[model samples]
Target: MKTHKEYLDLMLDGLENTKDKTPNSFSYDVLSAAGILFVEFARRFEELARKFDVDNLEGFELEKRVFQITGLKRKQATYARGLIKITGTVGTVIDEGKIFQTELGEEFRTLERAVIGDKGEIDVKVEALRIGPFGDVDKNTIKISKDYIKGIESVTNPADFTNGYGQESDDDLRERYYSYLQDPPKAGNPAHYRLWAEEVDGVGYAKVYRTWKGPSTVKVVIIDIERKGASSDLVEKVRKHIMEEAPIHWENLTVVSAKEKPIDVAGKIEVRNGYSKSEVIENIKEKITAYLAEVAFKKSYVSFAKVAHAILESEGLVDFDDLRINGTYDNIDLADEEVAVLGQVKLD
Candidate 1:
């Protein structure tokens, strides 16, 4: 897995190694030319390798070909949502797709047609045109596109706009492709429900349980891409998808978001003499976060031993004392619909 830069450095080292001992004619110009040639060739080789798989492909080619073969494509950019106040008479119409921009030039549009209110104040919502985490913006940052709308006093988000997600990553698409190939999604089986649940957008993980409520009852619990509880909208989307795909004879199906169970961590950390205690603590947090991500949807009990090991082995940490998860220093079990998330880490 050597990167292009690393390979280029190796080639340059070989050239230096071959410099004549007696003549010593390794001029800077010759070395610079060699470096440029190595870089050019390495980049071309990298491009050739990218063509080998859907995971490596990018841009339009990925959308047109690789994604088509895998049965999954990149997610398009999503819109940020917020409320806009319009001061106008009831007859006023805000057309769907009317554009707006933030002070930063991020564009947004109304989700649908809206009419003004009789009280001279109407609440309308808009979504950003561009996709990504950028769509999850703070309140009061949007202004109506000047030419289109008049008497627009101000825009404010009543709640956090967090539905925005970036295009699917190569790793994510690869997982879905492999899962589809492995199970191939047929009705009346747990695997079929799991596969269908995962196919929904924004779902990072899914698990299916038969007889969860009673005989002939199926429960599908899901976590979103951020490893948090799936939104109600997402839950409904999954439910509808399952309802349509499930066989007519199948029993009742319930799709629910995983409930978050926060766990607090407390410990006394000792860092080596040359290392900062804050840096060590931060590293411990990162390791714990990564551990949680890996075990979020599949396992019921998080390994307390693994968490202790992560903190003890952090790069700058010399040792830790009395490290406890929720004050017990033991593995905790979560119900089928519950997920564990880090809450607070107190280090002395």
Candidate 2:
């Protein structure tokens, strides 16, 4: 870990004890050049050493290598799929591969061919071209088509896309790695089921219940990366994966999406002078949503105090009066198979 100057000084001191100690001497210049290379090598060695340590490892490939020793691979992102309504003249044929896009340029392709019905509209299933939350567009935002189609006058999504999930983050991957190391899954235990469920793409967290139905029955409840209920497709994927990995003797495995327990907030609040009430309320909602995500599947109950604190820490809040979470001041208890989701936020 010696610096270039320190290495050079050490070499110079050795030279002084033998021959010349003067600056700009032949040995001094040579040692200075060597010191620069030596320092570079030292820096590289430090970095190389860090790569061996799990806490300091960098880059996706390197982390993947470390985790792969135990058969854990980084989960890839998942595409969002939803229904898009197409409107045009009756009998207009919409090709199976027709493309539609949102204002943000996220593209979706029709999964099936459909013709406009007698009502001049038909709902066709579509899948996002790319993976991740970018495809999770709001309802009515997908109006643009990649290419104009005859009789394809308009298109819109009636509901928001909610199943989109991004690639697993480094932190989340690392946490999974550590969990595997700390609690080694073996012989189809609950931890094994939970780990297997989370390994599938789009699964954020999973809770495993043993003997829920009978002696040999196991149930897994999962939430998506957005901390919302897992879509039917995602649930099927997890179910398939667990079935493939589960022991042959283990029968009756159920993979289901976690039930969403909406948390509604309503209160009276005072906003700072420069900030509008609406802005402050929006910020509070964001903070509360983040808190809910943090506690999802981790805490058995939503802390009432934490919700109030999130509102109190809003960017433009001056003071607050009465605050209620689902019209109750007490912590909201969640069932084991439930995930807390943010609902309505009303503030005066």
Candidate 3:
């Protein structure tokens, strides 16, 4: 017998294997499983946001919030949008506040639910504002720090990292990140629930790596196919395949949208290298987490340099390779100046 977690992993693995064996592309089941895997990823990410005190950190003093709109976005009039019911929660978050949310939005696509929190046991629940046909979700939660509570001021900017969520040390950031990613928080959404958030307030949505592509060439190929009618879920699978099949130059396949447009691509087809259907998806979980963590890494490094530098200032040294980051942060050792430097240094 398999546990619910095991069940999903098995399904995901099987689908990956199928993609390897099949030369054509992903099947309905594979596509469905991939989609479901992303949903689970979002659920887990939301869980991580809370665990990391993503809404607010004790070291750097950065906080954020997650919101959900229960109602649909319909046109009250030709030029106006009627947001039926508005909902969601704002709390402290540890990862890249603006960027991380955007990536999460792309991955989930179906705003199921979102939560915000700072610290302590209490996390506030905000309804998810979404686009269409969302699943049923019962409740959500959020938590934040006392000083960082002002993050919810106007949304978007939320809690500025400059203020500090109480997380002052790189060690603090690292520990919080590690704890959040490694140990997930408890989730209680119904099985039928699936979600997609309304982005910030209006223009854009929360962000995270939507999918991992092998290289520019492959991505170009994928964009063409996606525009032709292939699903982003399936397209992403194919992108992953290209990575395994073509170990080197997989990066060549990566290509980004010029304007973040859904798709209007046209390109050459026929990938020379791609994984067979027999190959299994290695680190599907890792892939998603890594993407989020890396995104957080970039933002955090930029935002918290002053504090990140302090750790190294004591030691007068810094090294990129030695940095240790858990899901939530690039951890620095408080006692050892060198260790602190490790987290302070940026990796190539």
Best of the candidates, TM-score: 2
Please give each candidate's TM-score.
Answer: 0.66, 0.84, 0.16
Compose the digit string of candidate 3's lDDT tens values, residues 1-348. Answer: 224445555555676434453323456445456656667777777767765553343322332211111222211111111111112344433222221122134111112232344332222222223332221121121122222332343222122111001111333234433443454322311110111111101111111122334222223221111111222433354445434544336545452221221101111112113432112112122232233233232232221333333323322122222322432343222211011111122222
Which stretch of 10 consecutive residues in model 3 shows the poorest summed lDDT?
191-200
Q: Give the backbone clash total of model 1.
A: 2
- How many residue pairs of model 3 clash at the backbone? 83
Model 1 misplaced regions, further than 4 Å: 1-108, 112-115, 137-150, 211-216, 249-251, 270-284, 312-320
The residue pairs found clashing in candidate 1 are 77-131, 80-128
Q: Report the error of model 3 at residue 312, Å.
A: 68
Task: List, residue by residue over 92-160, the lDDT tens digit for candidate 1.
Answer: 777888876667777777888887766766777787777766876656666546445654544445555
Compared with the true structure, the alpha-carbon lDDT of candidate 1 equals 0.73
RMSD of 2: 3.3
Which model, 1 or 2, shows the larger TM-score?
2
- Candidate achieving higher lDDT, 2 or 3: 2
| Model 2 lDDT tens row, 1-348 | 999999999888777445865668788888999999999999999988877767776557656665666788777888888999999999999889889999889899999989999999999999999889878889999999897889988999999887789887776777788888888899989989988999998889888899989888899999997788998889999998998899734358888899999999988898898999888888998999989998999999999999988888889998777888899878999998899999998888
Residue 199 Cα positional deviation in candidate 2, in Å, after optimal superposition: 1.7
